[model samples]
Target: MHFTSVQCVQGENFLFLVNNADDESSFTYEEKSGKGPRSWGEINPHWQACKNGTLQSPIDLLDQRVQVLSHLGRLNRDYKPAPATVKNRGHDITVMWKGEAGEIKINGTEYKLLQCHWHSPSEHTINGTRYELELHLVHKCSQGNLAVVSIVYKYGRPDRMLSKVRRQICGIDEQLFHHIKSVDPKQDKELGIVNPGDIKFGSSRKYYRYLGSLTVPPCTEGVIWTIVQKVRTVSKEQVRALREAVHDGFEANARPIQPLDGRPVYQYP
Candidate 1:
């Protein structure tokens, strides 16, 4: 069973906090991942200290009436994208996944869906339990406001998107990863967007809404988080595709949850 506890604490990501904000605390950058030279979300030795430390995000689930704002009605004013493009975010890791998609509208803002990546052992740990996988739907507004739709995976069935994602990358498993010399997330297959463009949205009315940081460091806060209570199921074959992707490490892609600092996590009214 996988449970995700998300908090909507409004503010910029913590990386900005440690750098720009004046009120710094041990919560800012004392963790392991914070000290490493890793890129925005990639793993590094720094994560070890972070896992042991407390100050993290996706805090406890709080019961309250969160204001349900209308989806942004901003349309893609100008959009022309490839099926997939690789982003060398400077962490020695290149994201060769999906591309900017002209779909999924919300709150007056028409956002473009970028690449979707997988996480093993899940990212959001609810109460104290974790899940098998998590899919991050990365979206960007024309103005540059970043919004992420986080979907947790439950194994036993194959999810179509997950299956397609696995076929894109080469080595997604540990034994094969450790057993082999090297694996390239960009080589040996497709490097493009692979999710359905016409999947219906607003299919569920229940969602946990919050303002939280990126689960991974530099643990930025102030991101608008919407964890849908209703999860879509995928085929078991789909789950294998993702499970076989990383196949290395102890499924350590998820970041530690930060302290709520008295923030409110609300369910849609």
Candidate 2:
């Protein structure tokens, strides 16, 4: 669960505080960092049966049917700067933020906003070609089921909103910087930053969703995914900024796309 701010209803990391992007669950661990990402609960060693699981996430949507996902629901988002403890690839400009009360419509069920994050080289690929980055907005039902809205960024027009975040992508923090120390995600201003048609006017109403695991470590499975068919755009500089923002010296952190494995990768009409 993501807690936007610790003061939000006096947040608790393990309690799943209904709406907290800063709620510890939002933290990610990097094996390369050695100390790993921060967390509020016990982090699992790895996914089941597969010790070193490569079936994590961000697979290229190759040869799969392209279909659109019915706009389930949407929630307003705002971002603020939460600096990183350490730098990656000589970049210290990593930022983390909290999500506010946003709306989400999932299969006719309404859920509130929870949290969001960014993955370099957008995890899900289209026809085997990966994007520069991917931003995920996660929502959850009161029952704890999850729904994720993803935005894929490619090299093209530079996203102005991203420029606000450019500082972290370029800043260098030699030591570890706990995001919990200074967290805020400034959102909304980037609304039209992405092509409107891509979301509302997507050229193809195509998508592929299946039961899968988290792309990062621990690789938790059973996540109900909703991948959009339309691809979004960003600037090459944006990609470079992100690539340099982590402390792990990682040029890329996305997991390769996993197989369908007899699982019906659904396509929406």
Candidate 3:
């Protein structure tokens, strides 16, 4: 199915649209395959943006190029506990909120929380240095635009939110293996009530903001990206658990850093 032709109804489940737009089994992280990231646009007509989009994401935040702007302000969020589920999507582990999980405000526009997923070795790098993990808090406004808040983690103390759902993450891997061995469809494990606030944003209110596209295929553009300035800590085991949870060939799922393309990167004070 072509993603560009998919009609998005206001307040509809954006995650559902994303999951169905492209088949996960059709492409892979391995570069040797013809269906890898570099060839995503050719694999399907709907994903031409993957190769042609000028505002692609996962760019390296070079310190020499950022413009510090205090007026950009702190990230304003009003999150709450919501019924959620954890799923191993073969490519990554995602925690999906099944109810109103609250929203984040940017430039006076409110974007409702949708879902968050993890990527190993961090998709966005700082001054060319990649971290151990990256967490993307996905949100969508009523107008169907997306705004993502990304938190990159280094190796040290365990992450608070990941620690909370460690057991569930392990179970997801087990279920995924079972499903792969059988003919049953994939399933999401109920994570009960999960509070988005538990995922800390660190002490610094500073962040780098820019416009970019989805790192995954379809590679939709115009996503508002807010990357936290502070690099938090996570245990080695935590990173290992996440990497092992996904199927093979996706263990290192971070996309190669895209060119800045002369886009201005703003840093908030």
Candidate 4:
């Protein structure tokens, strides 16, 4: 059976829709035989945005090149506990939120939390340094504008919230590997409520902001990107869980850092 999450973004959600189909060869890992990041444009001619778009994401952040701006304002995150469903999208673990979970206010605009997912070895690099993992909290405004908050993860004390999600991801992987009945998260009462704020701990108002596109295909641009300056931790076990959750023997799911192409990235201090 296939599953598709609710479409709350202008009634559009593409990731789940694309993955539910048996043929996802249009996009896979970098090391895989099918279409990867490099071949995104080839997979679909409309995906020329991935190649032709000037404001592509997953760019390397050079500290020296960042402009200091004090007017970015404080990031107001008001995430409340809400029911969530975790799904192994065959590419990565995704947590689809339910109900009025929370919202964030930045630059006088508020964006509602939609979902969060993982990317191994991170996508954005800090001064050319990559971390063990990365978490992307996707949000969108009523106007259809998107703002993504990226938090890099380093190995250290096991995060309680991450640990809980890790267990579910690993379990889901096991069920898929053994060809067991697919677990319906909606019917599982034992699943814990997810509070996005739990992962925002230790993150400060300081962050790097820029205009960029989604890291995946159709590689749509116009996303407001905010990458937290502070790095968080997930235990080594959690790292292993995420790595194993990825199907195939591929070690990483991160897209290679793209060229900035003269885009201005600012640091709010």
Residue 102 of model 2 has an lDDT of: 43
**Local accuracy of candidate 3 as per-residue lDDT tens digits, 27-119:** 778778777789988998878888998889899999998988887788999999999977777777788899999999887788899899888
Instruction: Score candidate 2 by lDDT.
Output: 0.45
TM-scores for all predictions: 0.58, 0.58, 0.87, 0.83
Cα lDDT, all candidates: 0.44, 0.45, 0.79, 0.71
Alpha-carbon RMSD, candidate 1: 9.0
For TM-score, the strongest prediction is: 3
Superposition error at 96 for model 2 (Å): 6.1
Weakest 10 consecutive residues of candidate 1 by summed lDDT:
18-27
Screening candidate 3 with a backbone cut-off below 3 angstroms (N, C-alpha, C), the clashing residue pairs are none
User: Which is the winner by TM-score between candidate 3 and candidate 4?
Assistant: 3
| Residue-by-residue lDDT tens digits, candidate 1, 1-269 | 10122222233333242211122121222235453323333343433423433333555453442444434222222334446533212111223335455544445555555544555555665445566666665555555445566666565555654343334544354332222123344343345554444222235556665566555544544455656554556554444433444423232545445565555555653
For model 1, the superposed segments whose C-alpha errors exceed 4 Å read: 1-56, 62-82, 85-99, 126-129, 167-189, 198-202, 233-244
Ranking by TM-score: 3, 4, 1, 2
Please write out the lDDT profile of model 2 over residues 1-269, one tens digit for every residue: 21111111221221342233222233344535432333212344322312343333545566654443344223222322332221121212322223334445545555544545567767787787887777765556556555566767767766544543333333444221232112223212221122111223145645566555454434444455667667666766556545544533345655546665544455554
What's model 4's overall lDDT?
0.71
> RMSD in Å for candidate 3, one decimal?
5.4
The TM-score measured for candidate 2 stands at 0.58
